[model samples]
Target: MRRVVFLVQPQVYLLDLAGPAEVFHTARDFGLPYELSYVADEPEIITAELLPVRCATTWPALGANDIIIVPGKQCATLEDVNPSERALSMLRAHHRQGGMVVSVCAATEALGRAGLLDGRRCATHHQLQDELAARYPAAEVVRDVLYTVDGNLATSAGIASGIDLTLHLIATWHGPTTAGRIARALVVYARRNGSDEQVSALLRHRSHLSDLVHRLQDVIDERYTEPLRLAELSRKFGCSERTITRRFRDATGLTPLRYQQALRLERAEHLIASGTTVEAAARAVGFSDSRTLRALRAAGRTAAAVAS
Candidate 1:
């Protein structure tokens, strides 16, 4: 099995470590060929959360298919982090041997110290964008992006962007379908492109978990182009229309019809982004009337404006 090894650094932020770890763990739970492990330079490491982290001290033999992730730590400045040179060297050596290297948030500093980010496009937390560029003149720092992929190196933005970056990696290694499934299971809105900052309405509307809600989401996700009425959904899973409606709303804060419409609208947006006309985009996502599509577009704009 290909290993997904996390390199734990001292004074690390817990979420930066846990987010990507849970992502890979979910992939493994889905029966993917991934062995998740953690390595540390010392027997125990201190976290900014005040919780101590301890993992394997001995480094495992890595292969080309293996991935090594360096999660960002909590600090006001990069100087506050104290990762050992040996750990940074391990990342450089792994990359040199054709292995993939990933960095989360401030973890890009570790990559910078190892000379891995030099002359490569990378991303980090927005707060540290200028500092990253100044510290590593050769590294091209991409701002306002969840993550960036430059050759074997990948870097993600702060905090929650780690999940989006890991999902992208999953789609890269597995496929878009698998990544979508994982994201749905995790109830996360997957970003098709890091440059797009908006999350899909379907994902944002998810409030809780329910088996019926998940089943309905899977069907709508897999076949959003087809006609999927509420009655059809009710019949497919042997649940009455009333039960499905109430339960779905209780779990996801939206009706089944609205959820399906959200999927169609999200696809329409993507189609337009890829050079399709507004009418063509609407038709491409199962809308027969451009009038309703126009209204949906207007409503979307209104919602975004309200949020902004």
Candidate 2:
């Protein structure tokens, strides 16, 4: 099993620790081979939110595929927070051994101090970006992005962005479909790859507050590859076909059938880009023939060309 170890520190941000932890935990629940653990220099650490958290004092043995995450903490400035040399050494040793090391928000300061950020591109919370850059001259501090991954070392902008970063990692390890399922379980949009234009079609058109439409979306997202009937959905949801169509359009600016087609088209594009043949991609995404997939691809290209 792949172990995910969170290196807990004093004044750790609660959300920074919980968000990614929940993503891994949820992924584990979905039968992924993941084990979550927490370690710290002491048995108890007081969080930034004034809550006491208990963790293991002894570090666990980690393999190359394992991960160690340093969650962001609360500090006035980089100088105000001093990490133990043992902790820094551990961070350096783990990365040197080819294990993955991650930092969230101000925790990038810890990675920076450990020399892991030297000549590496990293990201931190927006408020600490300037200070992180000034303190670590060798590190390239990326701005306006949720996270950055340089080799085995990764850094995120903390808080909710931590979730995005973790989801990205999950997608890398598993696939986009598994990550999308986990995101749906968390009631969040599927991982946004640090760009509005790159949001996954699995999560697009999900900003509305309509529970009915959202449920319809969940159904479509799960069964887009199958032949779904709006009348069946209307019967299942106890709504008229007209109501389902109107509400879906009102919430997402697309009918249910169109939304499902969008999912199929996006997935087909990914498969094709990954070297799958057009006919195979069409069959995989549930198209009856290559002609329909070709038509959709042509229309998509036309739309993009027009938009440009």
Of candidate 2, the 10-residue stretch with the lowest lDDT total is 189-198
Alpha-carbon deviation at 74 in model 1, angstroms: 2.4
Which candidate number would show the highest lDDT if scored against the true structure? 2
Q: Across residues 1-308, which tens digit of lDDT does each residue of candidate 1 receive?
A: 98999999887889899988988889999999999888998889888888998889988999988999999998898776567878888888999998999999999988888889888999999999999999999989998898998889999997888888898788667755577778777867645467776655545654465777877877877777788887888889998999999988898877888887887786677667657898998887788967777898899999989998
Q: For all the candidates, what are their Cα RMSDs to the real structure?
A: 5.2, 3.6
Over 268-298, each residue of candidate 2 has an lDDT whose tens digit, in order, gives 8878866899999999989999999999999
lDDT of each: 0.83, 0.88
TM values, all candidates: 0.72, 0.80
Q: Which regions in candidate 1 have their CA more than 4 angstroms from the true location?
A: 189-193, 200-214, 222-308
Q: Flag clash pairs in model 2.
A: none
**Model 2 spans with C-alpha error above 4 angstroms:** 189-191, 196-199, 209-212, 225-244, 265-308
Error of 2 at 262 (Å): 3.4
